[model samples]
Target: MKKYILKPGRHQFAPSSPAVHINDTLTDTEAKWYLQRFPHIAKLFIPLPTEGEVSTAKKSKMKSNQTEMEQTSAFAPPSGGKAGQ
Candidate 1:
């Protein structure tokens, strides 16, 4: 049984983050061995508050960019689905 850390999106796994990948499917000894080799994984176990802060920061940035896009598009006339029209 392989284990993977996944993001909230459907059917998507995050290969990069270490905190989300711990799995019991692997034999206990094997899991221990892997963790021992990649000690950085242990360090990435983020606390709830920190995760919340990170998520909020990302949401704020996204909202800001979206607002800017909406403002810009307001001035442009709707092109009738023509390429570069």
Candidate 2:
């Protein structure tokens, strides 16, 4: 089973911060299931790859930039707080 460390939103950009875990063999389908419950919050969790650093770089690039809120819909889910206040 693969282990996935879920860091909080505040520490999203910090690679060595504290984290929680989803220590099961999370298939693509299962990961999506948990993420759908809280997409915004889940977005911050960085899944550690068993492969090279390039994969991790690709993952970070996939994250949307939150500064430009005008580009995002107002009805979007909160980032588990006051929307990055």
| Among all candidates shown, the one with the greatest TM-score | 1
Number of the predicted model whose lDDT against the real structure is largest: 1
The residue-by-residue lDDT of candidate 1 on 1-52, one tens digit each, is: 3333322322212345434333433344654565577664443332234678
Off by over 4 Å in 2: 1-5, 8-21, 47-85
Cα error, residue 9 of model 1, in Å, equals 39
TM-score of each: 0.34, 0.25
Query: Candidate 2's error at 57, in angstroms?
Result: 6.9
lDDT per residue (tens digit) for residues 44-63 in model 2: 55665557686877666665
The 10 consecutive residues of candidate 1 with the worst lDDT sum are 4-13
Off by more than 4 A, model 1: 1-49, 80-85
Q: What is the TM-score (0 to 1) of candidate 1?
A: 0.34
Quote the lDDT for 74 in model 1.
Answer: 78
